[model samples]
Target: MPEPHLLAADTDRAAVVTRLDESLADGRLTLAEYEDRSARAHAARTYGELADLTADLPLPARREPARREPARSPVASALHGGAWHGAWGHDLRAAWTGWVTTAVIVVGIWLVTVLGSGDLQYPWPVWVIGPWGVVLLARTIGERRSQDTDRQQLPA
Candidate 1:
């Protein structure tokens, strides 16, 4: 069942080896069969010879192409200090702003209720603000530790 016509003049060693491996992996070849075919494939002289090695094997679905990292411009890379561009700074600032907004809103509501009642009400604002304050504190500490780690990792 080998397509003898598909075999041509130019064939490389890698192609032959690949086909033999495929045959082995596809279970078309037992270990002994693989070894024998692999030897023959290595000794193969032309494209036809290599094609014969895998002619009986079924082709598997193609795999996704490998990922490659995005290329960075030299000037932009230098300007951003390799790893300092976004790391934690923007996030920390936003977190602080969020905490301030929450605190102001809770206190404003609590103060209105207290003054309107003509007596100091229970400090109920603490209930709303305490949990948010704890969350922001933890986040700030985590960011500081992470930045310290990143700074340590940088080359001398």
Candidate 2:
């Protein structure tokens, strides 16, 4: 490793800014502190100056490269949809839950209105539910297509 007192490169400054941003997002630092540190990082001229801003923070975690597996069991593949799908599944599940919750609430309100009027009204809740469901479906399809494209481009 180089000496901390040495002049810093643009990359070094950028790294410090990224750390400050992460700290702010994780509630480790207040917005004011993050702004101050970020500005200092951009103006930093030496490695020591940049290091000082993040001295109290823990080191960032290092990510290991993804290891491609040759095959998955039929059940595992069906449940998880291979590697990329498994990674995106959690996010999709959350979005699906949100949609379901909203749909139930909207339908409940519509039912209450119909009972109060003593007549079946036009299903206005469908206007809210239909477009949202379509958008979610489109997003899922788009992501699946993107993952397929990525898998095809991978080295065999």
Best by lDDT: 2
lDDT of 2: 0.80
Error of 1 at 143 (Å): 0.6
All-Cα superposition RMSD per candidate: 25.0, 13.5
Give the clashing pairs for model 2: none
* Model 1 stretches with alpha carbons more than 4 Å out: 1-89
lDDT of 1 by residue, 26-125 (tens): 5566666766887887777666777777767766568798565476676775686653334445466545655666788889999899889999889987
Runs of candidate 2 exceeding 4 Å displacement = 1-90
Q: What local distance difference test score does each model get?
A: 0.68, 0.80
List, residue by residue over 1-156, the lDDT tens digit for candidate 2.
268879999998998898887776566887568778989999988888898999999887886987766567767765874534544443665576567768989999999999999999999999999998998897788677877888999999
N/CA/C clash count, model 2: 0
